[model samples]
Target: MSPILLTEDLTMTYHVGKVDVHALRGVNLSVAPGEFVSIMGPSGCGKSTLLHILGGLLKPTSGRVIVDGEDLAAVGDAQRTDIRRRKIGFVFQRFNLFPTLTADGNLRLAEHIHGNHRSKAELAELRREVLGLLGLEKKLHHKPLELSGGEQQRVAIARAVINRPAIILADEPTGNLDSENSEIVLDMLVRLNSQFRQTIVMITHNPEAAAIAERIVEMRDGRIIRESQPDRGAKRG
Candidate 1:
Protein backbone atom coordinates (compact mmCIF):
# COMPACT_ATOMS: atom_id res chain seq x y z
CA MET A 1 0.00 0.00 0.00
CA SER A 2 1.14 3.55 -0.64
CA PRO A 3 2.24 5.72 2.26
CA ILE A 4 -0.64 7.67 3.69
CA LEU A 5 1.70 10.30 5.11
CA LEU A 6 5.27 11.31 4.21
CA THR A 7 7.62 14.08 5.19
CA GLU A 8 11.04 14.91 3.78
CA ASP A 9 13.44 17.26 5.57
CA LEU A 10 10.69 19.07 7.48
CA THR A 11 11.68 22.11 9.53
CA MET A 12 10.05 24.82 11.64
CA THR A 13 11.50 27.79 13.47
CA TYR A 14 10.08 30.13 16.09
CA HIS A 15 11.27 33.55 17.10
CA VAL A 16 11.05 33.48 20.91
CA GLY A 17 11.94 37.05 21.76
CA LYS A 18 15.51 37.66 20.58
CA VAL A 19 16.37 33.95 20.50
CA ASP A 20 15.70 31.70 17.53
CA VAL A 21 14.06 28.52 18.72
CA HIS A 22 14.44 25.83 16.13
CA ALA A 23 11.43 23.66 16.78
CA LEU A 24 12.26 21.24 14.01
CA ARG A 25 15.41 20.82 11.94
CA GLY A 26 15.21 18.46 9.00
CA VAL A 27 12.86 15.82 10.35
CA ASN A 28 11.62 12.93 8.22
CA LEU A 29 8.97 10.25 8.56
CA SER A 30 6.62 8.04 6.53
CA VAL A 31 3.51 6.20 7.64
CA ALA A 32 1.67 3.58 5.62
CA PRO A 33 -2.00 2.82 5.47
CA GLY A 34 -3.32 0.63 8.29
CA GLU A 35 -0.10 0.95 10.24
CA PHE A 36 0.44 2.40 13.71
CA VAL A 37 3.64 4.37 14.21
CA SER A 38 4.75 6.26 17.29
CA ILE A 39 7.18 9.13 17.60
CA MET A 40 8.87 9.52 21.02
CA GLY A 41 11.27 12.14 22.22
CA PRO A 42 12.22 14.45 25.06
CA SER A 43 10.13 17.48 25.94
CA GLY A 44 11.87 19.89 23.58
CA CYS A 45 11.80 17.56 20.59
CA GLY A 46 9.75 18.53 17.56
CA LYS A 47 7.48 15.49 17.43
CA SER A 48 4.33 17.55 17.88
CA THR A 49 5.47 20.08 15.28
CA LEU A 50 5.93 17.23 12.81
CA LEU A 51 2.38 16.07 13.48
CA HIS A 52 0.93 19.56 13.07
CA ILE A 53 2.65 20.02 9.73
CA LEU A 54 1.58 16.57 8.60
CA GLY A 55 -1.99 17.44 9.50
CA GLY A 56 -1.65 20.78 7.62
CA LEU A 57 -2.43 22.77 10.78
CA LEU A 58 0.98 24.41 10.60
CA LYS A 59 2.97 25.29 7.50
CA PRO A 60 6.52 24.05 7.40
CA THR A 61 9.29 26.55 7.03
CA SER A 62 10.82 24.19 4.45
CA GLY A 63 10.29 20.60 3.31
CA ARG A 64 7.66 18.41 1.77
CA VAL A 65 4.50 17.14 3.44
CA ILE A 66 2.62 14.71 1.28
CA VAL A 67 -0.59 13.26 2.68
CA ASP A 68 -2.86 10.93 0.73
CA GLY A 69 -0.94 11.94 -2.43
CA GLU A 70 -1.40 15.72 -2.18
CA ASP A 71 1.67 17.91 -1.66
CA LEU A 72 0.47 20.34 0.98
CA ALA A 73 2.87 23.12 0.03
CA ALA A 74 1.36 23.05 -3.43
CA VAL A 75 -2.07 24.03 -2.17
CA GLY A 76 -3.28 27.43 -1.06
CA ASP A 77 -4.11 27.97 2.62
CA ALA A 78 -7.86 27.62 2.07
CA GLN A 79 -7.40 24.40 0.13
CA ARG A 80 -5.00 23.16 2.78
CA THR A 81 -7.60 23.83 5.46
CA ASP A 82 -10.17 21.89 3.45
CA ILE A 83 -7.83 18.95 3.05
CA ARG A 84 -7.05 18.97 6.77
CA ARG A 85 -10.73 18.88 7.56
CA ARG A 86 -11.64 16.20 5.04
CA LYS A 87 -8.59 13.92 4.81
CA ILE A 88 -6.84 13.98 8.20
CA GLY A 89 -8.12 13.35 11.71
CA PHE A 90 -6.48 14.93 14.75
CA VAL A 91 -6.58 13.97 18.44
CA PHE A 92 -4.77 16.25 20.84
CA GLN A 93 -3.63 15.72 24.46
CA ARG A 94 -6.21 18.18 25.67
CA PHE A 95 -9.68 17.13 24.61
CA ASN A 96 -10.72 20.27 22.71
CA LEU A 97 -14.47 19.97 23.03
CA PHE A 98 -17.12 22.59 23.59
CA PRO A 99 -18.39 22.09 27.12
CA THR A 100 -21.80 23.43 26.19
CA LEU A 101 -22.32 20.86 23.43
CA THR A 102 -23.29 17.29 24.00
CA ALA A 103 -20.91 14.65 22.69
CA ASP A 104 -23.22 14.02 19.77
CA GLY A 105 -23.45 17.72 19.08
CA ASN A 106 -19.65 18.02 18.95
CA LEU A 107 -19.53 15.25 16.38
CA ARG A 108 -22.23 16.98 14.37
CA LEU A 109 -20.29 20.21 14.51
CA ALA A 110 -17.38 18.48 12.80
CA GLU A 111 -19.63 17.19 10.04
CA HIS A 112 -21.06 20.66 9.46
CA ILE A 113 -17.61 22.23 9.27
CA HIS A 114 -16.40 19.60 6.83
CA GLY A 115 -18.89 20.89 4.23
CA ASN A 116 -20.25 17.40 3.62
CA HIS A 117 -22.72 17.24 6.45
CA ARG A 118 -24.56 13.97 6.63
CA SER A 119 -28.31 13.65 6.63
CA LYS A 120 -29.97 12.91 9.96
CA ALA A 121 -30.24 9.25 9.10
CA GLU A 122 -26.71 9.16 7.75
CA LEU A 123 -25.32 10.84 10.85
CA ALA A 124 -27.25 8.56 13.16
CA GLU A 125 -25.92 5.57 11.27
CA LEU A 126 -22.38 6.90 11.41
CA ARG A 127 -22.71 7.73 15.09
CA ARG A 128 -23.95 4.26 15.85
CA GLU A 129 -21.01 2.70 14.06
CA VAL A 130 -18.42 4.98 15.65
CA LEU A 131 -19.82 4.89 19.15
CA GLY A 132 -20.02 1.10 18.94
CA LEU A 133 -16.45 0.96 17.70
CA LEU A 134 -15.21 3.27 20.44
CA GLY A 135 -17.46 1.61 23.04
CA LEU A 136 -19.06 5.01 23.55
CA GLU A 137 -22.63 4.52 22.35
CA LYS A 138 -24.06 5.13 25.79
CA LYS A 139 -22.37 8.43 26.46
CA LEU A 140 -23.52 10.43 23.43
CA HIS A 141 -25.85 12.69 25.35
CA HIS A 142 -23.39 13.57 28.11
CA LYS A 143 -21.59 16.87 28.04
CA PRO A 144 -17.84 16.96 28.64
CA LEU A 145 -18.13 17.68 32.38
CA GLU A 146 -20.45 14.77 33.01
CA LEU A 147 -17.97 12.29 31.57
CA SER A 148 -14.61 11.15 32.86
CA GLY A 149 -11.42 12.43 31.27
CA GLY A 150 -10.87 9.18 29.41
CA GLU A 151 -14.43 9.15 28.17
CA GLN A 152 -14.14 12.69 26.90
CA GLN A 153 -10.99 11.78 25.05
CA ARG A 154 -12.78 8.86 23.47
CA VAL A 155 -15.47 11.24 22.34
CA ALA A 156 -12.78 13.39 20.78
CA ILE A 157 -11.43 10.39 18.93
CA ALA A 158 -14.90 9.50 17.67
CA ARG A 159 -15.27 13.04 16.37
CA ALA A 160 -11.94 12.87 14.57
CA VAL A 161 -12.72 9.65 12.71
CA ILE A 162 -16.37 10.40 12.04
CA ASN A 163 -15.34 11.53 8.56
CA ARG A 164 -13.19 8.45 7.88
CA PRO A 165 -9.98 10.42 7.44
CA ALA A 166 -7.13 8.89 5.50
CA ILE A 167 -4.78 9.36 8.44
CA ILE A 168 -5.14 10.14 12.15
CA LEU A 169 -2.60 12.37 13.85
CA ALA A 170 -2.51 11.84 17.61
CA ASP A 171 -0.37 14.04 19.81
CA GLU A 172 0.13 12.78 23.38
CA PRO A 173 -3.32 11.28 23.39
CA THR A 174 -2.91 9.70 26.81
CA GLY A 175 -0.88 12.42 28.46
CA ASN A 176 -3.58 13.54 30.85
CA LEU A 177 -5.01 10.20 31.90
CA ASP A 178 -3.96 8.00 34.76
CA SER A 179 -2.47 4.60 33.98
CA GLU A 180 -5.82 2.84 34.05
CA ASN A 181 -7.48 5.51 31.93
CA SER A 182 -4.46 5.60 29.66
CA GLU A 183 -4.71 1.88 29.09
CA ILE A 184 -8.38 2.18 28.26
CA VAL A 185 -7.67 4.90 25.70
CA LEU A 186 -4.62 3.16 24.24
CA ASP A 187 -6.46 -0.12 23.94
CA MET A 188 -9.16 1.61 21.93
CA LEU A 189 -6.54 3.09 19.61
CA VAL A 190 -4.93 -0.32 19.16
CA ARG A 191 -8.27 -1.92 18.47
CA LEU A 192 -9.04 0.80 15.96
CA ASN A 193 -5.83 -0.04 14.15
CA SER A 194 -6.29 -3.79 14.35
CA GLN A 195 -9.97 -4.02 13.52
CA PHE A 196 -10.58 -1.17 11.08
CA ARG A 197 -7.04 -0.85 9.75
CA GLN A 198 -6.98 2.84 10.68
CA THR A 199 -3.73 4.51 9.71
CA ILE A 200 -2.21 6.31 12.72
CA VAL A 201 0.80 8.51 13.45
CA MET A 202 0.99 9.28 17.16
CA ILE A 203 3.43 11.38 19.20
CA THR A 204 4.11 10.31 22.76
CA HIS A 205 6.73 10.89 25.41
CA ASN A 206 6.20 7.82 27.54
CA PRO A 207 8.12 4.64 26.74
CA GLU A 208 5.25 2.40 27.81
CA ALA A 209 2.77 4.33 25.70
CA ALA A 210 5.10 4.33 22.70
CA ALA A 211 5.62 0.58 23.02
CA ILE A 212 2.06 -0.04 21.94
CA ALA A 213 2.94 0.92 18.39
CA GLU A 214 4.35 -1.51 15.83
CA ARG A 215 7.35 0.77 15.39
CA ILE A 216 8.86 3.60 17.40
CA VAL A 217 10.93 6.44 15.94
CA GLU A 218 13.06 8.42 18.39
CA MET A 219 13.66 12.11 17.96
CA ARG A 220 16.41 14.23 19.53
CA ASP A 221 17.45 17.82 18.94
CA GLY A 222 14.73 18.05 16.27
CA ARG A 223 15.83 15.13 14.05
CA ILE A 224 15.17 11.41 13.91
CA ILE A 225 17.87 9.76 15.97
CA ARG A 226 16.82 6.18 15.32
CA GLU A 227 13.89 3.91 14.64
CA SER A 228 13.20 0.59 16.31
CA GLN A 229 10.89 -2.20 15.31
CA PRO A 230 10.47 -2.87 19.01
CA ASP A 231 8.29 -5.83 18.54
CA ARG A 232 11.66 -7.20 20.01
CA GLY A 233 14.02 -4.84 21.87
CA ALA A 234 13.94 -2.94 25.15
CA LYS A 235 11.60 0.04 24.90
CA ARG A 236 12.94 3.57 25.09
CA GLY A 237 11.59 6.81 26.53
Candidate 2:
Protein backbone atom coordinates (compact mmCIF):
# COMPACT_ATOMS: atom_id res chain seq x y z
CA MET A 1 0.00 0.00 0.00
CA SER A 2 1.10 3.51 -0.68
CA PRO A 3 2.00 5.77 2.19
CA ILE A 4 -0.75 8.08 3.41
CA LEU A 5 1.73 10.88 3.96
CA LEU A 6 5.20 11.57 2.56
CA THR A 7 7.66 14.44 2.72
CA GLU A 8 10.70 14.73 0.46
CA ASP A 9 13.65 16.83 1.46
CA LEU A 10 11.26 19.19 3.24
CA THR A 11 12.81 22.52 4.16
CA MET A 12 11.39 25.62 5.78
CA THR A 13 13.21 28.91 6.30
CA TYR A 14 12.00 32.05 8.01
CA HIS A 15 13.49 35.42 7.36
CA VAL A 16 13.65 37.18 10.71
CA GLY A 17 15.54 40.44 10.54
CA LYS A 18 19.03 39.89 9.18
CA VAL A 19 19.25 36.16 9.80
CA ASP A 20 17.57 33.24 8.03
CA VAL A 21 16.31 30.63 10.44
CA HIS A 22 16.05 27.13 8.98
CA ALA A 23 13.19 25.37 10.70
CA LEU A 24 13.53 22.21 8.63
CA ARG A 25 16.39 20.98 6.52
CA GLY A 26 16.30 18.12 4.02
CA VAL A 27 13.81 16.11 6.04
CA ASN A 28 12.23 13.07 4.42
CA LEU A 29 9.53 11.07 6.16
CA SER A 30 6.59 8.80 5.37
CA VAL A 31 3.58 7.47 7.27
CA ALA A 32 1.71 4.53 5.85
CA PRO A 33 -2.00 4.06 6.12
CA GLY A 34 -3.02 2.56 9.48
CA GLU A 35 0.39 3.30 10.96
CA PHE A 36 1.09 5.27 14.13
CA VAL A 37 4.33 7.27 14.24
CA SER A 38 5.67 9.63 16.88
CA ILE A 39 8.22 12.38 16.43
CA MET A 40 10.34 13.47 19.40
CA GLY A 41 12.75 16.35 19.71
CA PRO A 42 13.81 19.12 22.04
CA SER A 43 12.50 22.66 21.74
CA GLY A 44 13.29 24.44 18.46
CA CYS A 45 14.20 21.14 16.82
CA GLY A 46 11.47 21.44 14.10
CA LYS A 47 9.09 18.60 14.96
CA SER A 48 6.11 20.91 15.11
CA THR A 49 7.23 22.62 11.95
CA LEU A 50 7.27 19.28 10.16
CA LEU A 51 3.80 18.50 11.46
CA HIS A 52 2.43 21.79 10.15
CA ILE A 53 4.00 21.21 6.79
CA LEU A 54 2.51 17.74 6.63
CA GLY A 55 -0.89 19.11 7.54
CA GLY A 56 -0.67 21.75 4.78
CA LEU A 57 -0.87 24.65 7.19
CA LEU A 58 2.54 25.94 6.10
CA LYS A 59 4.12 25.74 2.69
CA PRO A 60 7.69 24.65 2.96
CA THR A 61 10.40 26.80 1.45
CA SER A 62 11.52 23.86 -0.69
CA GLY A 63 10.71 20.20 -1.37
CA ARG A 64 7.49 18.24 -1.69
CA VAL A 65 4.74 17.05 0.65
CA ILE A 66 2.44 14.37 -0.61
CA VAL A 67 -0.77 13.54 1.32
CA ASP A 68 -2.87 10.65 0.23
CA GLY A 69 -0.98 10.73 -3.07
CA GLU A 70 -1.59 14.43 -3.86
CA ASP A 71 1.47 16.64 -4.11
CA LEU A 72 0.90 19.63 -1.84
CA ALA A 73 3.64 21.77 -3.37
CA ALA A 74 1.89 21.67 -6.72
CA VAL A 75 -1.41 22.90 -5.38
CA GLY A 76 -2.67 26.42 -4.87
CA ASP A 77 -3.83 27.76 -1.51
CA ALA A 78 -7.48 26.87 -2.03
CA GLN A 79 -6.67 23.38 -3.22
CA ARG A 80 -4.35 22.83 -0.29
CA THR A 81 -7.01 23.96 2.16
CA ASP A 82 -9.54 21.63 0.58
CA ILE A 83 -7.11 18.71 0.76
CA ARG A 84 -6.39 19.42 4.42
CA ARG A 85 -10.06 19.53 5.31
CA ARG A 86 -10.84 16.33 3.50
CA LYS A 87 -7.74 14.30 4.37
CA ILE A 88 -6.20 15.51 7.64
CA GLY A 89 -7.34 15.77 11.25
CA PHE A 90 -5.37 17.84 13.73
CA VAL A 91 -5.18 17.77 17.53
CA PHE A 92 -3.27 20.38 19.40
CA GLN A 93 -2.00 20.81 22.98
CA ARG A 94 -4.71 23.38 23.47
CA PHE A 95 -8.13 21.85 23.06
CA ASN A 96 -9.18 24.90 20.99
CA LEU A 97 -12.82 24.26 21.75
CA PHE A 98 -15.30 27.04 22.03
CA PRO A 99 -16.24 27.80 25.64
CA THR A 100 -19.89 28.34 24.81
CA LEU A 101 -20.24 25.16 22.77
CA THR A 102 -21.16 21.85 24.31
CA ALA A 103 -19.09 18.82 23.44
CA ASP A 104 -21.59 17.67 20.83
CA GLY A 105 -21.94 21.16 19.55
CA ASN A 106 -18.20 21.39 19.03
CA LEU A 107 -18.20 18.18 17.05
CA ARG A 108 -21.18 19.22 14.99
CA LEU A 109 -19.36 22.41 14.13
CA ALA A 110 -16.46 20.43 12.82
CA GLU A 111 -18.73 18.34 10.65
CA HIS A 112 -20.30 21.47 9.29
CA ILE A 113 -16.95 23.05 8.55
CA HIS A 114 -15.65 19.91 6.95
CA GLY A 115 -18.71 19.88 4.66
CA ASN A 116 -19.79 16.40 5.58
CA HIS A 117 -22.58 15.76 3.10
CA ARG A 118 -24.24 12.92 4.93
CA SER A 119 -27.85 13.22 5.88
CA LYS A 120 -28.72 14.51 9.33
CA ALA A 121 -29.36 11.03 10.68
CA GLU A 122 -26.10 9.69 9.29
CA LEU A 123 -24.17 12.63 10.66
CA ALA A 124 -25.75 12.17 14.08
CA GLU A 125 -24.86 8.51 14.01
CA LEU A 126 -21.29 9.26 13.12
CA ARG A 127 -21.09 11.80 15.95
CA ARG A 128 -22.43 9.30 18.46
CA GLU A 129 -20.06 6.58 17.34
CA VAL A 130 -17.04 8.82 17.53
CA LEU A 131 -18.01 10.20 20.93
CA GLY A 132 -18.62 6.69 22.18
CA LEU A 133 -15.23 5.57 20.95
CA LEU A 134 -13.61 8.38 22.93
CA GLY A 135 -15.80 7.67 25.99
CA LEU A 136 -17.43 11.06 25.80
CA GLU A 137 -21.00 10.06 24.91
CA LYS A 138 -22.38 10.95 28.32
CA LYS A 139 -20.74 14.34 28.41
CA LEU A 140 -22.00 15.46 25.00
CA HIS A 141 -24.02 18.30 26.47
CA HIS A 142 -21.28 19.61 28.69
CA LYS A 143 -19.28 22.63 27.61
CA PRO A 144 -15.52 22.68 27.61
CA LEU A 145 -15.32 24.50 30.94
CA GLU A 146 -17.52 21.90 32.63
CA LEU A 147 -15.25 19.02 31.62
CA SER A 148 -11.90 18.00 33.09
CA GLY A 149 -8.74 18.48 31.06
CA GLY A 150 -8.76 14.85 29.98
CA GLU A 151 -12.38 14.98 28.95
CA GLN A 152 -11.81 18.15 26.97
CA GLN A 153 -8.93 16.57 25.12
CA ARG A 154 -10.97 13.45 24.42
CA VAL A 155 -13.71 15.58 22.99
CA ALA A 156 -11.12 17.30 20.86
CA ILE A 157 -9.95 13.94 19.59
CA ALA A 158 -13.48 12.89 18.83
CA ARG A 159 -14.09 16.06 16.94
CA ALA A 160 -10.97 15.50 14.89
CA VAL A 161 -11.78 11.90 13.95
CA ILE A 162 -15.54 12.13 13.45
CA ASN A 163 -15.15 12.68 9.72
CA ARG A 164 -12.74 9.77 9.34
CA PRO A 165 -10.07 11.85 7.72
CA ALA A 166 -7.30 10.01 5.92
CA ILE A 167 -4.75 10.85 8.62
CA ILE A 168 -4.52 12.49 12.05
CA LEU A 169 -1.77 14.93 12.94
CA ALA A 170 -1.41 15.51 16.66
CA ASP A 171 0.94 18.15 18.05
CA GLU A 172 1.85 17.92 21.73
CA PRO A 173 -1.53 16.36 22.50
CA THR A 174 -0.68 15.60 26.13
CA GLY A 175 1.37 18.69 26.82
CA ASN A 176 -1.21 20.46 28.99
CA LEU A 177 -2.41 17.50 31.02
CA ASP A 178 -1.19 16.04 34.29
CA SER A 179 0.44 12.63 34.24
CA GLU A 180 -2.82 10.81 34.98
CA ASN A 181 -4.72 12.73 32.34
CA SER A 182 -1.88 12.34 29.89
CA GLU A 183 -1.95 8.60 30.35
CA ILE A 184 -5.66 8.51 29.73
CA VAL A 185 -5.32 10.58 26.57
CA LEU A 186 -2.45 8.45 25.34
CA ASP A 187 -4.41 5.27 25.91
CA MET A 188 -7.36 6.68 24.01
CA LEU A 189 -5.04 7.52 21.13
CA VAL A 190 -3.57 4.04 21.15
CA ARG A 191 -7.04 2.52 21.19
CA LEU A 192 -8.06 4.71 18.27
CA ASN A 193 -5.02 3.64 16.31
CA SER A 194 -5.36 -0.02 17.11
CA GLN A 195 -9.10 -0.46 16.81
CA PHE A 196 -9.85 1.82 13.90
CA ARG A 197 -6.52 1.53 12.11
CA GLN A 198 -6.24 5.28 12.08
CA THR A 199 -3.15 6.74 10.48
CA ILE A 200 -1.52 8.97 13.08
CA VAL A 201 1.56 11.16 13.26
CA MET A 202 2.17 12.71 16.65
CA ILE A 203 4.73 15.22 17.85
CA THR A 204 5.62 14.86 21.49
CA HIS A 205 8.39 15.73 23.91
CA ASN A 206 7.39 13.05 26.40
CA PRO A 207 9.07 9.73 25.83
CA GLU A 208 6.15 7.85 27.36
CA ALA A 209 3.75 9.37 24.89
CA ALA A 210 6.12 8.58 22.04
CA ALA A 211 6.39 5.00 23.20
CA ILE A 212 2.72 4.47 22.59
CA ALA A 213 3.33 4.78 18.88
CA GLU A 214 4.63 1.85 16.89
CA ARG A 215 7.68 3.82 15.76
CA ILE A 216 9.62 6.66 17.36
CA VAL A 217 11.41 9.25 15.18
CA GLU A 218 14.05 11.45 16.74
CA MET A 219 14.76 14.86 15.23
CA ARG A 220 17.51 17.36 15.89
CA ASP A 221 18.78 20.58 14.29
CA GLY A 222 15.86 20.50 11.81
CA ARG A 223 16.31 16.96 10.53
CA ILE A 224 15.35 13.45 11.49
CA ILE A 225 18.30 11.81 13.26
CA ARG A 226 17.00 8.31 13.77
CA GLU A 227 13.90 6.13 13.72
CA SER A 228 13.22 2.95 15.70
CA GLN A 229 10.50 0.76 17.11
CA PRO A 230 9.66 1.32 20.76
CA ASP A 231 11.17 -1.12 23.25
CA ARG A 232 8.33 -3.03 24.82
CA GLY A 233 10.52 -3.74 27.85
CA ALA A 234 10.98 -0.06 28.59
CA LYS A 235 8.87 1.51 31.32
CA ARG A 236 6.14 3.94 30.32
CA GLY A 237 5.44 7.20 32.08
Q: What lDDT does the true structure give each of the candidates? A: 0.87, 0.90
* Candidate 1, 1-237: lDDT as tens digits: 778888888889988899988999998788888889989989988888888999999898888989889999678899899889988889999999999999989998888787675687877787788889888888989999999999999999999988767788899999999999898888888877776778988898888888888899999989999999765244212
Best by lDDT: 2
**Superposed model 2: Cα runs more than 4 Å off:** 233-237
Candidate 2 on 1-237: residue-level lDDT in tens? 989899999999989999999999999998889999999999999988899989999889999999999999889999999999998899999999989999989988999899977898888787777777788878999999999999999999998899988788999999999999998888888877877888999999999789888899999999999999997464333
Q: What is the lDDT of candidate 2?
A: 0.90
lDDT of 1: 0.87
Q: Which portions of model 1 miss their true places by more than 4 Å?
A: 117-121, 232-237
Check candidate 2 and list the clashing pairs: none
RMSD of each: 2.8, 1.9
